[model samples]
Every structure is written in C-alpha cells, then in structure tokens.
Target: MTNIPEGKQMEAAIQNSFNEAKKLYEKHGIDVDDVLEQLSRIKISLHCWQGDDVRGFLNKGRELGGGIAVTGSYPGRASTPEQLRDDIDKAFELIPGRHKVNLHAIYADTDERVDLDELAPKHFENWVKWAKQKGYGLDFNPTCFSHEKASDGFTLSHPDAEVRQFWIDHCKASRKIGEYFGRELGQPCVTNIWIPDGYKDAPIDRLSPRVRLMEALDEIFSDPIDEAFNIDAVESKLFGIGSESYVVGSHEFYMGYALSRRKTVCFDSGHFHPTETISNKLSSWLLFGERLLLHVSRPVRWDSDHVVTMDDELLDIARELVRGKLLEKTHIGLDFFDGSINHVAAWVIGTRNTLKALLRAMLEPVDRLKEIELQGDYTSRLALVEEFKSYPFGAIWDYYCRNAGTPVREEWLAEVKRHEREVLCKRSQGEGSVV
Candidate 1:
C-alpha cells in the first residue's frame, strides 16, 4: 500500500502550505488573515427551495406551474419541513461561516390550511423559532406562482380585478411575514416579488399588462412597513418557459420601477440572456441604487438553474463586488435547484464554490491594481491580474475551511456520502419513493 499521511500529518501539511501562501500574499501587500476575516463576515442566503425541489408544503401534489421545473428524480428529497430543515442543517455544517436562509410564502410551516391570500406571520412562526435557534437570519419571497390563480400564467397583472387583487393581498401578507422575521431576528428581511405574467406568443397590447402590474405594485407598497424590519425588492426575468415571447417584468421594467419607487432590484445570475453577465451591471446599479439583491446561480444554456461552479463569471462577480466595495450594500442569496444529486451536496458544492470565488477575489491586491491602472500602465495591470491567477489561492482557501472548522479541500464529499447513506437513503427506502 502507498504510504499515506493521516490526521496530524495531513494537518501539518496544510499548515505549511498556508504559511507559504500567506507570505506570497503579504509580498503583494495583501493581509491574508484580514481577508479571511472579511470573508467570514459575508453571509450568503441559502434558498430553501433547493432542498424540496420547489415543492412547497402548501398545495401538496400540485404541479410546479409558473415556468418552474426541477429536473431529476433525485433520491432523498425532503418531503416535509422537518426533513428540509435537517438537510439544510447538514449543508450548513459543511459550508464555512454563518449564513441566512431564504424562504417563500409557500414554505410556511403550519397545519392550518391557508391559501396564499390568507397567509400570515403566524404561519411562519415555527420557521422564525427554528431560525432563531440556529442563529440564522431569514429572507422572504412572495409565492406568486404555482397556484390556481396563476394557472393562466397571470398574477398581479391579471386582467380580472379579483385575480389581481388576490395576488396583491398575498404579497402584502408576505411583507408582514418578512417584517416579523426581521423583527424577531434583529435583521432586515428582504421580501422579493417576482411574478410570471406574460404571454406565450407576442401580443399587441403589451402595455396594458405592464400598466396593471405597476398599479398593483403601487397598491402593494401603499401600506409601507418599517424598512428597518422589511426591505422590499423586485426581480425581473429575461424569459421563462411559459413567458418565452413576452415577460412583463423585464430588466428595464423593474429597473425603472425600482429606481422610481426606491426599492431594491434583484439581479439573478441566470435571469438574463446567455451572453449577458450580471457582473458588468454591478457598478452601474450601485451608482444609482442604495442597495441590491443578488440571486447567484449558474445557467448552462438558458436559465437552467444549475448548481453554481467557480467559473470565470463567478470570479468576475466576486471581484467586482470586492473592487467596487459593494458588499455592504448587497444581499447575496442563492437561487438554483438541482435534483439530480443529493440536495445537501448540491447546497454544499454551490455555496463552497461561491465562498471560494469570494476568497480569491479578496486575496487580490485591489489597491495596487487600481494604482497601476491609474498610472496608465495597462501592460502591468493585465500582467499582474493574470499572474495572480496562478497564485496559491487554493492554499489560502484550504486554510479558511480548516480555520472555520469545516472540511478542507474535498474532505466534505465523504461526509456528504456518509449522510446520504445514513440519513438520505433512509428517506427513500422508508417512503418507497424518490423525488
């Protein structure tokens, strides 16, 4: 057998690499320890939909309408709130640093049968209690899709006054829930609204639906909740399955609305055209807006919602946030569901990659690069940027994971497999079903 270093030996090896990497970074005028501390403070909101594949507790057995779909019949899918929370706990254990959890109106944990419009803060009381116990902040979203009222692919912009009012009421109620969470948790809860109101084919009267949406949004925001507790946001999409031809909430539409109404505009990574990247939009949006909400996701082709990887765009996004000093004004949340693999593993992989990207970005000598560019040394700027790419970023990242008391390198994967065998596999076998 090959002689393999274990336990203390492996730890010593990691420490040696980290020490050498720290020196290299120090030479660049970068404080590796300070960078790690800054990285620890940045929390990404973990979306709860990934655990249950977007199948919320309310309206069980209901098909996922509103242009949403979760591929793969991945085994060990959480069927109940308890299971979902447990799975999320496992993911949190593996991911370094503390984070928040984002919840939808449909994820209300209660036995009382309540429709969307009937939802209240009481329904989410259990969630708040659990979040408090786990020291997690909570974020909320109005569930405007996958409901009977939205069956015709129209929600807040529906022509029928009753139909539109129903969604409006639901959104208003969602705001209350968000406010409650923030009040109890001592952090502002971002309640984002995204509706699937559009036509499958091009319609001549595109203006009417958008006009109705604007009016409804005005009504929803009419009764202002305390901003200290609840911060509202509007998300726009390029296109979805049902709204392929025309999506009411386009980028320009929400950008205009958000600016005019002084609301946060959410930029979902997978919500734009394949060629368009959200990283480029960060600086412009920050210049005009007070705050931003980001839904970081990976799109393979067209808003496919793949698990995020440490790709070029992801690195650029992280770099932009660090360079522009936008982290303080931004709320980072994940938005993707991949049922093909273990849900906990999906969360771990996506979240870890996101943190890794941020760590690499923070390790860069941003001030030096800016100084070089200001000096008109374009050649040196490009050279330094490319050279930093080959630096021992991995060593620093491994050190971060180790210091956080989380897994270093690929050590977390074995834990995921062990959890799958011990906890996840039992769910499928006991229920005799796979999600």
Candidate 2:
C-alpha cells in the first residue's frame, strides 16, 4: 500500500496522460477544450452543483481557452414572489451575459400554507419585473411545484384534497411565473418537471394522477404562453434507504407518454441504472429529434447520487446536446444537489467532473479514427465508459515518484493522503477534523 501510487498523483498522472494521448488526434485541430465546448460549453451551475471541483477545472481549462455554462440550485426552491425577484437579480449579476446559464427552472415555496390568490400573481410579477428591468441576458431559472405544504410532490401525489388543490394552484402559479419569464427575457426560462413523489411500496394508483396532472399541463401548454418554457422531463432514479423505498426515475417516461412529440428529454447522468448507457440513450433521443436538456451528476453505485465523477458520461451528454443530433431543440439545464458531503465541494466537484467529461467527449478522431467514429455511436461510448478505456494515471504518477527519490507506489499513496488532507481542509472550512 505504501509503495503504491496515490490517488491524487494518479489523477494528475491520468490528466497528463490524457494530454499526451491528445496529440494522437491533434491533426483535426481538435483538443480537449474544443471538444468540451461542443458539450458543456463549460457552463457551470451556481447552486451546490458548481462547487470547487468544477471551479478548479474550469479555471484551469479556461486558462487554456475553454468556456462554461452556469446552471445552479436556486431554481428548485424559489416559489414565492419575493424569492423569485431576489434570485433573478442575483442570476443577472452573477450569471447573465455569460450565457453559461440557459436559465434554471426554480421552485419557490415557503413554510406557510399561503393561498395562491394572495401570492400567485405576485409570483408572476416578480419574474416579469426582474426580466423587464434587466433588459435581456439575465439567465435565471423557475421551479416545478410547491412541496413544503405538500411534503410529497404537490398536485401530483398528495392524498389530501386540499393538499392536492393547493398544489394544482401552485403549478399554475409556476406557469404564471413562467409567462413573466418568457415575456420579459425574449426566450424561455426553463421549467423542469421532476417530483419527489413515489415509493417502492406504494400502490399503482399513485401513478394514476399523472395522466390528469399532465392534462392540466396540456391545458396550460395549449394556450401557447408556456410553449417557450423549455419544459424538460427530468428523470431521477429511486433508492432503498433506511426508512422507505423512494420514488424516482419515472418522470421522463411519463412526460413522453403524456406529450409524446412535444416535450424534451432531459437526461440526468446518475438517474439511470448503473448499467444504463448514457451515450446509447442519448443517441436514441437524438434519433427522436426533440429538444434536449441534461441533469448531470455521477453515481457511487447505481442510484446513489454522489456528485463525484470524472466519468465519460459527462462527455457524451455534453457532445450530444451541442451537436443537437438528438433533442434537436435542446436547452440544457442542471438538476444538481448535494444531499451529503460538503455541499459546496459536492457542487464544485460535480461541475469539474462535467467539464472533464466534456473535454473527453470532445476528443474527436482524426481521419485515422474514421472507422472508430463510424462504429463509436452512443452505444459504443457507454461500452467505452464501462470498459474504463482510460490512460494509466497510476503509471504516470509512478514515474514522478521515482524522480522524487521515492518508491513509485509508496509515493503515490502518500500523495493520495496529502490530497485527502487538502480536501478535508476545504470541506471543513479550515475546521476539518477526523476521528
């Protein structure tokens, strides 16, 4: 163990090797950054999803001529009128003109059981006011549904009639807000539909509500005001936890079932089964030729949404979105959050991982790669990921350890420890302590 290459050293080694490997296809004038742009465009989200890991990579990548997009967390919880205005202002100042943020679909709900008549129109005003005042280029997001009053997803799964009614009203409140967003911004302020409503143990009737709920949404879309809203069907995966089996990964299917040809398929990297191939699914989506958005992150195990990855899915998602090969009208967005870990680092790490993935995906083949590219459609990309088709970071780090007068693997392990310490410092905000 002591003689082995450390993790960070391995990472650095991997990165270096990737650079060297990059020379293999430089004939196309294509390198990592260009490929990255084709995917993520280096767009960084602000919420917890755009934390240190992402910033570190973006800073490094941009120094070498890469760009990023900004999509973040505020969009998920800003359902109230006042919250919408404040969040929008921040997005304009922090994220606008950058175009990194294609606007997020945020939810604004307070702890109180407020009547929509009292605040729904105000929610609309908050958005309109922000967009009108900013004069275009303020990329912000909107929310899906109110969940505070209705713990499970509002309007969709609530059992109490009042709870359900309240949710329906708020869904409309969300639309009212959307209208203001589209009218003032000159384009859609994205609204993603992913609900925290479902159970591994619940009856099938729980799904019954979706058809009616979709009908309601259909009615709204029929009016044409919400057409430009960038309505993405955000699909998530369920997990078996200590308390209950949760509901997830069902939204995307429903959105398809409900609207078929109308909505965009927003793929979350971690939302599928571990064996799921993002490249294959995305390719099919491209073949489908609708608008696309992405809710990206990584998995520790399948369905365990740990936002730490240098996984290749990041690359595939970014590339497909940019090419507009699938979801021809794609307006990508992020459905990212860090349930555990230093929330900041989680977001930053997620972002960095996304950037690296973008770079990897952008590694186009030369005329020599014509055969591989022809064979390397989305399905092949997934196999590449599973195949762990990567450079040897361990070998690279070993070479460096030798220069440091240390045994290769031992030096590598030490470097990994050092890196952990450094990560702890950041995570603890200088107070990181371990037992």
Give candidate 1's whole-model lDDT.
Answer: 0.93
Candidate 1 local lDDT, 1-435, one digit each (tens)? 766668777788889999999999999899998999899998999999999899999878889999999998778889999999999999999999999999999998889988999999999888988999999999999999998899999999999999999999999999999999999999999999999889899989989999999999999999879999999999999999989999999999999999999999999999999999999999999999999999999999979999999999999999999999999999999999998888999999999999999998998999999999999999999999999999999999888888889999899989989888888888888544432
**Candidate No. with top TM-score:** 1
User: Model 2 — TM-score against the truth?
Assistant: 0.58
Q: Give the alpha carbon lDDT tens digit for every residue of 1-435 in model 2.
A: 556667677667656765665554464455544543344233343341233222221112222101112333221322233433443333323221223333332222333344442344343343355546655422333233332453344344456656655545545555555556665667665555544455535655645555555554554345444566434343444433310344533636544643474665556666666777565566666565455566665666654455646655666665564443343355544544443343333433454445444444444332324444577675655554444345333333333334324334433334324433554333344343432
RMSD of each: 2.0, 11.8
Candidate 1 off by > 4 Å:
1-5, 430-435
Give per-candidate clash totals: 0, 49
Which is the leading candidate under lDDT? 1
